[model samples]
Target: LVKPIELWTGKQLFSVLLRPHANMRVYVNLTVREKNYSKSGETMCPNDGFVYFRNSELICGQLGKATLGNGNKDGLYSILLRDYNAYAAAACMNKLAKLSARWIGNHGFSIGIDDVQPGGRLNENKRARILEGYGKCDELIQSYNKGMLKLQPGCDAAPTLEAHISSFLNNTRETPAKVCMEELHWRNSPLTMSQCGSKGSPIN
Candidate 1:
């Protein structure tokens, strides 16, 4: 009853979770250090990619594992338990479960054919990467067959070729993941989920 506006969006419900009462407040920063984000302060980020909470209100950044995940010693739940008590943290978790369930139920999420389909550029780059990997493996195989392959410190020629081929193929998989991540739109549902560290990864 104290709040002015009628809550309609999932965001409105989230704000209430952040500021349950008028007196309680939290100030937090959980933005990652990367291309556009500065380590000093994220307040100046143009894309609002930085996570900052001021006066118990979420001012910027997407809510992701950095804020909600357990591994972080300074995550939201950890902060709540530290400042208040275990009960406070548990209560907040309960709120999250209910809110997420209801919100997702109301607005369903899915991965369409368009979501997984790669663009022309990505396909071309991926093909090139695969060919490069195969080329390296072929070179190693030819050396081994000719008995000209250099041996590892404790490994024989066959083992050395296998090791080199394995490493190159691993990169063949990893590089395309980075390219795919760059090619997808920020708003794409699967991409959003992966970026948030909720489920799936760039490789998936």
Candidate 2:
């Protein structure tokens, strides 16, 4: 008779989905978690909050869209398909869909304005970054109008100016987004939803 193995934690259950057999191995790297873990030498969260999965088991990290989303080729679904086969990925997806439905039936979830609205230090950082980016953009615009803008490779002054401005704006946007994530509590509804890949991404 086959002995039943009990999964005592969600991480164990996830590992089972990825590596049903002892011979199977899955390596996952959640960049966001890794970045934070690397800071202040807190890599060992001791509660499975690590950015990496050692032997397909989450030892110390939270799962996020980077691992779960369909947007990337390195996502769990993609990894399953690549390391095993399409059938494996499909089977995993079916289980996930069913489990998610069951979970929803017993849970109530919502995102209120309070959950995402910037406040205090987060708002100050956002405004400061925007002002800095705007000033740089204005400088670039002034240069372009005066025909003193540096042209990008294979691009004219206007395109070069636009490219630089866009890059600055994007960095500006990302700065606040990062600050916002840091300011929000880990248990914050929107943040948790973003981290778990049950809804929108962290940037959203």
Global local distance difference test of model 1: 0.74
Count of residue pairs whose backbone atoms collide, per candidate: 0, 7
- lDDT by residue (35-110, candidate 1, tens digit) is 2233555766654446666645665555677777736776778877887788777877898999888878998777
lDDT of 2 at 95: 76
60-128, model 2: which lDDT tens digit per residue?
Answer: 555665566746775667766887788778887887777768876787466688887888998788888
The numbered model that scores best in TM-score is 1
**Candidate 1 residue-wise lDDT at 47:** 41
Cα shift from native, residue 157, model 2 (Å): 1.3
Per-candidate TM-score against the hidden true structure: 0.73, 0.60
Predicted model with the maximum lDDT: 1
* Model 1 stretches with alpha carbons more than 4 Å out: 1-16, 25-60
